[model samples]
Target chain A: MKDRLEIVASGFGGQGVVRLGQTLGEAAVKQGLRVTMLKSHGTEMRGGYVRSQVVLSQKAIDSPMCETPDVFLALSSSAYNRFKDTVPAEGIIVYDPAFVEEIDASLPCRQIAVPAKDIAVRNFKRPIFSNAVALGSLAKLLETMLEKNVVLESFLEVIPKYKDENRNAFEMGYETMNI
Target chain B: MKRFLETGNFAITEGAILGGCRFFCGYPITPATELAEAMSLRLPQVNGVYLQAEDECAAMHLCIGASLGGMKSMTATSGPGFILYADPYGWALGCEAPMVVMNSGRVGPVSGITGAPGQGEFYLTRYPTQGGNFETITLAPNSAQECLKIIVEAFYLSERLRMPITVLGDQLLTDGMEDISVPENDDEMKEMGLRVWPRLYHKGPDFYPASDALDIPPVQMGYDTGALCSDWTPTVEGYDIEEVEEHHKHAYRLIYKVRNNPQLYEDFYEKKYMDDDPDLVVVSYGTPSRVVNTAVERARSEGLKVGALRLINLWPFPDRHFSRKTKYLVVELNWDGQLVREVQRAAPKDAEVKFLGCCGDLPTIPDLMETFTKMLKNQPLERKGWVLEAW
Candidate 1:
């Protein structure tokens, strides 16, 4: 595991971008790691730009702004275009193909496509659980730094309403990831 | 200690409750609105009172009223709402009401941006209300965990100083989430350096004392102690007085009580790599200082002589930290350079001072590193279309 892990998730509003970051941050805190999560959103409630920057470290985190994210979760085309270059050559960019139709092939970082929205719709019949799918993929990617069961438990604790569906969606996401 | 990833607003709400703030009256505004919402939910669970006022002025006035009635009171607002607090803020100051006012600042001359952070209120907090004959106590904590301790300390200081204390935060600090460990009991609270001064009503016919004293219990209503609370210049016995000598005594107490009692908050600052006297000192407060600290640490690793001076206690200026003659750079979240002027005034006459200003967003580390390199080499920072003049 790296000394510091930076995870950035950006999409339009109401996409649970902040919630995704919060769940990961909660899991990191439960693991006794220092974490900082900063969420910025546009004025409108929906369809406005939204971004969540989460930084986790074993020691104190000085800068909350994720300048170079170890993992970039691009949930939308605009988000993918905006932060694609911020991922270093060794980092990974996990993007949802439903929102990010086009990918930047010239980027040095490994770009993986996760059909979170389609998987959520096919299984849960709702796009709201797409965040769970995304988290599952992130959990698989961050296996070295975070415990998968701990992340799942924290995710359930944050979104407590759906238990079985979220768990299934998470497992599906974890299975779908190329990692 | 119980750890949770929470926003600064949540931490501050718990801090206020732990600090014996039983009453909170505030109007909702962006960034600071969540604080009032948290207070509304948490205050009732602890058998406290939460009121949503019609406006910012009424909210602060209600807090003042609750404070006068022997309750540790508080209010929260953003920059635009804070301007409306000018009237009640002065009233609380003149009446010596013990309360806490939190200004979670956003970009604004007047409501420029509702959701973004700004440090335009650096000077506004010092001179919050018109006709400044008093010294204001404002604490700017850099993180969510520190916000809890700072709010608790603010409530403690307000009671001891017998005046309103301000907790200045920006949107990022108040709304950002981090791992915050809340105390489970009084022992834990004490271990975290949190202090709480119970609201004490003065048992006196002389509620308005002429002497500049610390821990003089504020005048509380319904005590039947002949205590008077008014905005007018008050006599020693709590009568409305117009004589210059009486006003002078009242003003003297208002000013010197905080100025003379610097020990209460003088230690509220952080110095990194400053013992050996680095060639450059980066001075800042609030959320911006977090990035500055990171940049300074990185600069030191690269063999650059740079230090960071972060002020938690913003008012009374903490001029002692700037007594050294060195190249100083003041970074803030405003383009107009408010805190830079104070650094220029407080630093030695021959010391070089500069300003790096950005609004609506935090300054990037690369920008800070580049600027540090320039300042160390004695090269001018030439950003196109920027004046870059001396503060």
Candidate 2:
């Protein structure tokens, strides 16, 4: 069986980490792929660390939990340090340079740091849209399977009223990703 | 249609309404509070009555009263609230009033967590209520969609059997959201008999009229009897029971009626999957059964030839289905081996029974898969206890 792709998104609570994971999982489901999304939150809803794992495959997923992730998206420095070691050898580490300033320089996997929060604030006028920007970047990285337009459409489906801001945030991330 | 994406709570509320439930009384409890909130908002639009009672006990009793008055009624509460309504639940059983109780279970024995999921109430609902000889029908759904479908069925079954039925749902199923097709119209529902309530009491002044009495109202409690009183003892002509033999006879008759007419279960998979004259059977229910089902499929793929038996109706335990070929019986549940004991007693003497249990907020599917793999491989299955942390 082909290996399934598992993505883990981590950040502080209320950073849209859960929503970002859900949007990607829903996009996968919409594309006729089997997906499972598992989310965990700490006691405090605002500052405590929150994480979500999204598993995608052509076959039915047996368990929702992911022990090793293929891609780890850490929007906060603390979350990056906490989960960086769990990524597999061939995994990719994507971080927000605006918040996560340091990373283990000797890590084996490919690393990409983007100014997600800066882009969100500068272009969308909302720092909360950073997660949407990160989602667009992640979609670009997985361009072989998912289209940038599909990710933008899924983001629109989730953020019901903020059409212009969300679209701009997604576009900024799409343009930033060299891939 | 206004496509307001709904939560699991709203789905269940809509399903209950589709089931013809016109009266809902409940107390607010976490995880389950959303169910009441949705019902409160929608009930008025449908011309239904939704009351938030002072406490769970009052809420349960209020549902019983509404049900007795011949309106399809229900109540939703969590574990703590379920305990409070134990007495009222027993009374409803004794009186043979049909109503549905939705238990959106959370972690606990005593308010463990407000927003976590737990399947600890598996055995509590499986047994008879407050020293009764019979068990109420309990249905557990793994997904929010099933939550919607099952509550409607619960009402139908409860009314059909003249017994209170419970939808034993956990926070995972109650709080999660899913895409569900809206239910059909009243005419379609009537065609499927989803709106029908069974004949319990005799109808009208005349027992047998010259014409077909299809339009006459059924002879309900207050209309048929002269007086209304809250007496536990069976009263003949509205007087307190003086005869001991008559009271015993009345109680025994009611108990026997329910016990004898136990609801038969619907086996999810075929009996042949029990194996080509296989040596073991795995007994499970609810969410655990879904894991078992996955494990059985995996085992079959590995050429182990194992099978699963899931009890849709846990209460009316299908004792008649036990067989000599069933050599080993494994009972898996989310509680600390609570239902295993019952399965062990019910299995044949030649069959060896074992328990693979957990009290974790969410039972690990991998653990179940590993256990089933070991059992099918003829390896010794490890026995351990699990105590999940409070949220």
Query: Which candidate number has the best DockQ?
Result: 1
Candidate 1 lDDT at A148 equals 95
Query: Least accurate stretch of 10 residues (summed lDDT) in model 1 chain B?
Result: B382-391
Candidate 1 clashing pairs?
A: none
lDDT of 1 by residue, B1-391 (tens): 8898999999999999998899999899889888999999999999999999999999999999999888999999999999999999999999999899999988888878776889988888999999878889999999999999999999989988888999999999988999999997888998888874456778776788887788788888776676667778978787777788889998999999998989999999999999889999999999889899999999999999999999999998988998988999999998889999889889999999998999798999999999999999999887645675554
Model 2, B1-391: lDDT tens digits are 1222245677789779988788999998877888999899989999999999999889988888887677888999888888888877887765556788888777677887655566677777765266654556677766555566677888767765566888887665566443344556766555544443443553334421222112323224565554232536444343445467656654664455446555333431224277475545767665455556666666677676667776656665556556554545444435456556666677777566666655534445556667666766668765555442310
User: Alpha-carbon error at B125 in model 1, in Å?
Assistant: 0.3
The DockQ-based CAPRI class assigned to model 2 is acceptable
- Stretches of candidate 1 above 4 Å error? B384-391
What CAPRI grade goes to candidate 1? medium
List the RMSD of every prediction in angstroms: 1.4, 5.4
